[model samples]
Target: MADDFDVVVVGGGINGTGLARDLAGRGWRVLLAEREDLASHTSSASTKLVHGGLRYLETYEFSLVRKALQEREVLLRSAPHLIRPLRFVLPHAPHLRPAWMIRIGLFLYDHLARRELLPGSHGLRLAGGVYGAPLKPEFTRGFVYSDGWVDDARLVVLNALDAQARGAEVLTRCAVTQAQRGADDWQITLGNGRRLRSRALVNAAGPWAERFLRDHTQGANGRPLPARGLRLVKGSHIVVDQRFTHDHAYIFQNPDGRIIFAIPYQERFTLIGTTDVELPEHEEPPARAAIEAAEVDYLCEQASRYLARPVAPADVLWTYAGVRPLLDEGGSASSVTRDYLLEADAGSGEGGAPLLNVWGGKLTTYRKLAEDGATQLGELLGKAGQPWTAGTHLPGGDLGRHGVDMAAFTAELQARHAGRSPAVVARMAHAYGSATAGLLASPGREIAPGLFEAELQHLRDKEWACSAEDVLWRRSKLGLHYTPDERAAVAAWFDAR
Candidate 1:
């Protein structure tokens, strides 16, 4: 078919970006269209953990847990620069789920996957462990487990970059306004008045999946699809001055049954969050205002229950919220499934075009989700390509010879950048992995006072970072460390450049 693309993905979130990379790498012509800048949506607003959703075990989502657990290692290996292991301390509270149940859950979690680099879960004497110094005296016992943290936005960009490098077209600020199936190909119209044709379509539009399908009619075959629906749950997080002494994160259970994380963010700050509340589907740019007084009270109450110092909304330096487009599972917000559901509305024949809709998914399982999506697309398109993303590295993720040995990588980085703080080296190593060499290649030159001029230029030149928010909030958490004046200076430099 003489079409603009073989596959047209309608969202620039992680799922769409990953799928684009997967399909493009498999030698298919692919085009990824995003309404806004990439990762401006839920992709950047995640809890920043590439975990197996350990809590999902309570819901008996074994399959989802297993897939996520397996993907955790895949992500850590592929993007060691942007993803790293994080130790989480779960205090054994008598009021919460019993310790026996927790232990059993942890046991199942460890056994679900063939773990390699990350260590297994272990019981801890909170009074004797490194985390003990920061917690209250009463919390004397806890459990420590491993999960991976990610720079969610960069994950999207890296996938897009990889896809572009492999013969895919990635269009930012281009919205898919309309679509129609024409004979053997799908005709699509963009908001910018551009038209394109594709043999297949993927509605991996995250929150906009339903709307995208609703605006576009069924294909010529008229196959029925599930009435597209999603539960918009707004999750909010607050950033404050660092509160804990150790690097370990804390998973605390609130009285209301929701869980929160106290994570060490950007070295000098703590990230604590997330309250769940139902929101209208039409709410664009899910407002951080929904971070209610009650939610803040709940977070502070939970944090105070464990930490040596008290936390309150007044202590908050920044706050943000994201709407999780969960598949309509007909349950309370907390019980909703985080797994994705794919709806295909294409017929079986020589003159067939397909429309694939993605309902729900998390950051941790994005790659696997994309691979699976590509496999389904292959089936629909009758295209022959073996799955190849499991071992492939994303952009700037090549750790030559060292082979995912973080300790040795950090040691080398510390030696090379002797004048920079150890914490800075560690942060860069975690953010860029072996790619840190590219970031620090110009050793003696200062980028812009606190902001590395080279880093800023690299972001601008390569990462599709157009605004200050794209750099500070999404690309890296350097904003947390920079003063208002310094941030303004960086913004001015970006504008001037």
Candidate 2:
């Protein structure tokens, strides 16, 4: 017998989890299926900025920039622990972009949306200044602007957690192998052998969205539905030993009209990235996008142009890549719009089931995308619910008595766990927010430095962590700090369990 659901969402990335949470909160019976762990793809491999895409202003993408800027404030308020304010320094490059042009762009960026939590942008004299210390001596002028940073993977998991708490079933490591549209519902088969019937279906498979439609879905009359066009662009980032001690990030302009970011990461490393290289449409992206040697050379060379200390490929500590599924607009990969389009189909009209296909979205706008997408799907399915996520806090986001002040909360947590390492305490406080009390209540055996057995058990029991990679890379970035032996120990712990 096929289990029943109001909606069956495919993929466990940001959009899928966010949509599931939104729909589930509206009283819909939701079943979210992920072929792998949550945010194991494009979502987690981001440059980790929650900004308004400062460069988009150059292309006259005012509407897109405004929408993302508005959402930026909403996200900052929603999850202060996982998302925090970050300042970026854009060194003056008169050859690349004139100062007047950059000034106008920053002006628009500052006033595009109502700013509350963050300050406005301003010009900076980079010579002999703290912000200029890391840059080459020739860089004398720059601009500083406000944006936000996020733990991208945790954001996805938190959405899934909230969905589950609201009566949705979250199934990771479960793929929707087959889905048939019936007159009133979707009959779906999973790789795990479970069968389900859902009134509506959502295709949010990220980079694999088009492929899923082509391979796994069929029309109500068993005919094939043509998939929408998507252009796959591969973006890669590299992590290196900390280059600067300050809390600011840098945005360097490249001769190719593309930009690169060198951001402070994990308290000890500098994260640099993101080269846009388009992949052939006929070829499928790898399960894990690996950084190409050319991409690495490009990033290191671009960043080195501004930094006082030169960066070589050998300096890279770790690297990651993600394929962005963009709307197939013919142009250079960097010029394509970062906006998204939601296409909904009501099969056979009348009592026919409806399907919503999500295409082309950025990390900064996932929440708004979910809100808008849910509103549309809800109306189509006659299950519309007033949007409530705008004013709500995500799970572990409510820092009671601290409001959006994460530092205060972390200090208090450190005091409470005086016997523990301050680093571990601070990480836990920021990671779990108010939930840190429960995470440290027992503080079971210390499996590795700053990693406790209790935390591992909590991940396995509540967060659906099944492997060391899930715990190290996605759940937390402790992988960067762990030695090879320590990582193996973590793997051994999971193996033993």
For model 1, how does the per-residue alpha-carbon lDDT over 149-174 read when each residue is reduced to its tens digit?
88888889899999999999989889
The TM-score between candidate 2 and the true structure equals: 0.99
TM-score of each: 0.93, 0.99
Best by lDDT: 2
Residue 300 local lDDT, model 2: 95
Against the true structure, candidate 1 reaches a TM-score of: 0.93
On TM-score, the leading prediction is 2
Superposition error at 279 for model 1 (Å)? 1.2
Q: lDDT per prediction? A: 0.82, 0.93
Model 1 CA deviation exceeding 4 Å by range: 1-3, 216-227, 281-290, 347-352, 417-426, 443-447
RMSD, candidate 1, Å: 2.7
